[model samples]
Target chain A: MDSIEHQDHPDRELLEMLQEAEAKVEQLRVELDRRREFRRQMRADEAHEGTDEEVERLSEYLEQAQINWQAVRKFFQSAIEEYRADDAWGSGRPGA
Target chain B: MSQTIRDESTDSEHGVRQIEVDGADTAAPASPLRRLPLTGRPLRIVEWLAVVAAIYVMITAVGAIGSGFEAATGGQAEELFSFASNPFVALVIGILATALTQSSSTTTSIVVGMVAGGLPIEIAIPMLMGANVGTTMTSTLVSLGAASDREQFRRAFSAASVHDMFNLLAVAILLPIELIFGVLGTIADWFAQLTTGTDGGIVTTIFTAFGDAVSAVTSPGADLIEAAVMGILPEVIGGVLMILLGIALILLIIKFIANMLKSLLVGRAERIFHAAIGRGPISGIGSGALITVMVQSSSTTTSLTVPMAASGKFSLWQIYPFTVGANIGTTMTAMIAAFGFSGVEGTAAMTAAAVHLIYNLFSATIIFAVPFLRPLPVKGAKWLGDLGAKNKMYVLFWLGGLFIVLPAVLIGVSTWVF
Candidate 1:
């Protein structure tokens, strides 16, 4: 909703933050939905990063004592995971 | 099933360390240069056979050490081990021995054997506690492996060092109380006696039968080794030789067995962690204990958590309970090794083993149950990790200084002082 409509609301400040560049209530709604979708995509990427294949790979690295490489690669993988999430948000659709 | 676990790091792109894996290749791990024993069905069987042989060697090693000490000391065991008479010195010995071998199971097994042979119970207890502290070194180093990647190194170091903090805290809390009150030993002694029974009875008979079964398998090898050594040298020298041989066998055989078991069981461990890590602390602890038992090393258990922690998938608090479970799990080896002796010696060996188990359980229970104590390890690890990212030198000091150099210095100073 517009900042004017939420003047007496408990989350008025939050609405105003979202409405900073947008004037109409419809535009504010789209902004909130977009943010929500972005968060959902980030969570999905996190789950994918923790998949069984990755666990298997991590376990093998550790068992073989390639610990330094494991840590470094996983660091790279974390950056990649976050990057994918951000990329999806920028493209306006995941896997675009 | 031959598994391609590691492809060596090469500069595929200028800045990247492309140490990739083929998920398609499934089964076992081999080092970069060697084929290892994971090649096929027959080889897997051979690997398992080697693991079984390692257990036998481990048992006989404990026995050989016990009997070897008996021969060398000629009933002067206390005088021979007089250096460890100081509890602090004994503690340092435990730390140094375990740190050197990188396996607390080996150190504790030897300690149990020594205790059975006549090392003072009081001296052995501190050494056992020190083993717990020393065992954290390998995983802590695993965390330090990421020194070039500061953020990952910091978080990974925190995850790895949490175990170090917990064990250090446990020793700090328990050692003084243990020295003064003899709380752990009293319970252990009572339990040992109750199970073994000084007087002839059904319980004692059953215990004797079981001990005989164990001794029957181990003593022949130990006696044969002792006799061979004795034939080549004087009794005292042979005893010393046997002690060295036993220590070497325990160390080398354990590493060999650990590698094979890791190859065979890493899949199970990975599966368990995936299923259990997010479930809560108890699930984390139980899975940690289970995997350590399966793979036969707490270092393996804790080391497996490092990459996950570094990746930021699991927080340090989530990893803490698992490492705590690992401390408890490693006592299983010592308990099995205790069976190397039978009759009265067996009772003492078992008693020392019991003390190791009880101490871990008691420490874990006390730390977890007390609200104030629970967060100490996680907090301490986080602090060290934050520091480690900024100053790599401090990480070296913590790893080498606390685990090795500090213990050695204490032992040296104690020798001159007391």
Candidate 2:
């Protein structure tokens, strides 16, 4: 069956929640990529200056971004998992 | 039958797909010589032969220095090096010489030759200790490359400084013990006697014969080279010219040998680093010693760890034993140079080389055995690195004080005043 057809089943709310969680995951992925690219550029720029302070600042920024990414990723993962569980329960087929 | 958790063939999978890209012969593409049949084996043999030749050249260069020193000073080199009578001054000379040259192997080899030429064994002992301390500067210098990145610098510097701290600590503990007890020196004398044998014994005769052959072949060419250099320079500078030429030859030959050995053994080195270094300290020490002995350069071996540590693939503790092993391994050059002399000179030279080996062995046994003492170098290195990360100037100060300022000041004072 098409994913859209599955979305229209009795557990429509759970399916919609799943769709939203997926969108959030994609968004986070894009954000992570952008952050990584920005950090890469910052590193390249800091290399030319070759100062310790700029390098330290860049390191701190990357660490904070990693924490933010982990939090967002964990949130979306739980949301998607919960949607899957509810939809399965409502359909009366736990394995499916 | 067991079911797979993730199947890459499935088109609907949403998680990161397992891309099946072949590993692409990424292991440094084989050269044209390697691609050719039969020629590759011959080339490998030639490389090994070249390594042997390099060692021979190094030994001849060391012998040249000894002979040159004797020629330069007219049998009075001993009086000039009399300042080395003081252990502290001698130690400083060793450290300064090694730091300046960037190779303890070269420094110790030169020291061995000097001893054979007439530098006192007691004086050479402290210099040997200094060489150990001086060699650690190479890795510390390498760690400076990571300074631009704070975290990397922290890891790299700590990794690098553990070598420094360990050697310093070793000298701090052992040098005094040596000064008071002469324990290491006495044992070295015993060992040197056993191995070198009497003047007419087999070992001495063999060494004497070999020395004769080497001198016969190299002395003429060496005299010619000295004459050519002296022709341009004044008569006053002839001795200095020959000594400098010998040292330059030593450094160049060693660099060439180390590079050749690295290329020859890089694959084995990779396997050893990956599989053996992480197993335990014993394995790590073994691998470290093995690689250093293979390359004939502890600087090459220890400086190698800075990048690995900087990448965060390895920790300072893991690299610590390897550094210790490097300390032990670098004694091989001096040991080999010991044979270049005959009779009493050979015995004295061998004694100095033995001192180097015994000192490292004793230091490794004592420091690594005591759990409390074991972590001191690692902790001290980390602390210094942490401070360096906050302010890069701390590392600069450390490098300057330990390697440059301290050695330079000590050497100057020792030369004129001592």
Give the top-scoring candidate (TM-score). 1
lDDT of 2 by residue, A1-96 (tens): 546467457777778899999999999999999999999878645433322222122212212211133433443343345346743212344322
* Model 1: residue B187 alpha-carbon error in angstroms: 1.6
Against the true two-chain complex, what DockQ does each candidate achieve?
Answer: 0.09, 0.01
Native interface contacts kept by each candidate, as a fraction: 0.16, 0.00
- Candidate 1 lDDT score at position B86: 92
Q: How high is each candidate's TM-score?
A: 0.77, 0.69
Which of the numbered candidates is closest to the native, going by highest DockQ? 1
Error of 2 at B307 (Å): 1.2
Docking class of 1: incorrect
lDDT of 1 by residue, B162-203 (tens): 989999899989998998899999998877776665766778
Q: Give the 10-residue window scoring lowest on summed lDDT in candidate 1 chain B.
A: B10-19
Scored against the true structure, residue B58 in model 2 reaches a CA lDDT of: 78
lDDT at B306, model 2:
76
